[model samples]
Target: MALVASLCNRVIVMYAGRIVEQGPTRAIFKNPQHPYTWSLLRSMPRMDEVGKERLVSIRGVPPDLGKLPTGCKFHPRCRFKVDRCLTEEPPLGEVDPEQLARCWVLMKNVSNPEMQS
Candidate 1:
C-alpha cells in the first residue's frame, strides 16, 4: 500500500475533496501518530482486547467529495475531536520520526513506547 501511494510524489488525501492530510507514505504510515490514526488503530479489533467481536469502525459514512464541508472535514466522525475541531481545519503536520498527522491531538511531540525499532 505504501509503495502504491508513494509513486505519485504526492498523496491526495481527500476528505470531501479537501486535502486533510498529505505527505510521503512512509512518513505518514510509520509515524502517523495522528489522533485519527490512533483512533483508527484502536477501532481495529485486536485478539487481546477481550470481548472484541470485530474491528471498530469510524462512526459515519464518508462525506460526498463533491459536497465537501467547510472547516475540519473529520469533525463529525472523529472520536478525538475537540471544540476546535468543529470550527477550524487542522493542517497536516509532521509529528516527528517522519510522521504526518492531520489531527490536533496526535500532532504534538511524543514518543510511542510500543513501536519497535
Candidate 2:
C-alpha cells in the first residue's frame, strides 16, 4: 500500500473479483468512499504509529470465489452495511469529483464512530 501510494497516481480497489472503488490515490487514501476501502485502510499498519497503534482487522471471513454472495459481495463483512446491501448490488457511482465507489451506504453519509477523529 505504501508502495502504491508512492508510485501510483490513481488506484482501483477490488473485492470479490469486482471493482469496488477507483480514484486518485491521494483522494482515495485521504477519504475512502467504500466501507471495504475504509476497513482496508484501517487494517494496514502505519509505520509512524508503530507499536503505539493496534492494527484493526476486518470482521468475518472472505467469501468463497466459486459461490459469492448475492447483492453486494462485501455486505456480509462490511460494518456499514444497510438492508439494501443484502439484496441489491450497488453501482459504481461517483462519491466525489474524481472518486467512484460501489456501496449502498457510502462512508460520507454514514456516521462511523471509529472515523470520528
Candidate 3:
C-alpha cells in the first residue's frame, strides 16, 4: 500500500464517508495508528512460509452515508470502540509531525503509540 501511495506522491484514506487518515505514504504506512488503517495493514496475508495466521477482516459493511447512523458511525464495526464512540464524532488529530488520523481514541490521546519504526 505504501508503495502504491508513494508512486502517486499523495495518499488519502476514506471510510464511512470520511477521510479517516492521510499523509505521505512512508509516514502513514510506517506509522499507521488509525484503527481503520491498522485494520487495513493487518488484513494483509503473510508471504513467509510459517505458521502465519489468516488475515483479519474489518467487520460489517460501511454505513450508508445517505442515511448515516447518528454520532460515531463506525461504532458498530470498530474493534477498538469505546463508550465515547457511540455518541460523539471524532475529529482528526495530528498523530505525528506529518500524519493525521480521525479516531476518538487518537483524538483524545488514548490509543497506544504507533508500532515502533
Model 1 clash pairs?
43-56
Q: Which stretches of candidate 2 lie over 4 Å from their true place?
A: 115-117
lDDT of 2 by residue, 1-117 (tens): 999999999999999999999999999999999989998998999989999978888999999999999999999898788799999999999988899999988888987548643
Instruction: Arrange candidates, best lDDT first.
Output: 2, 3, 1
What are the Cα lDDT values of the candidates? 0.58, 0.91, 0.71
Which stretches of candidate 3 lie above 4 Å from their native place?
48-51, 107-117
**Which candidate model has the greater lDDT, 2 or 3?**
2
Global lDDT of model 3: 0.71
Task: List ranges where model 1 is wrong by over 4 Å.
Answer: 2-12, 36-54, 65-70, 96-100, 107-117
Candidate 1 on 5-98: residue-level lDDT in tens? 4575644345555555556665554544554554454565555767845555667887777765566787777655668877778787665544
Estimate TM-scores for all models.
0.57, 0.93, 0.78
Residue 86, candidate 1: C-alpha displacement in angstroms? 0.8
In model 3, how large is the Cα lDDT of residue 1? Answer: 61
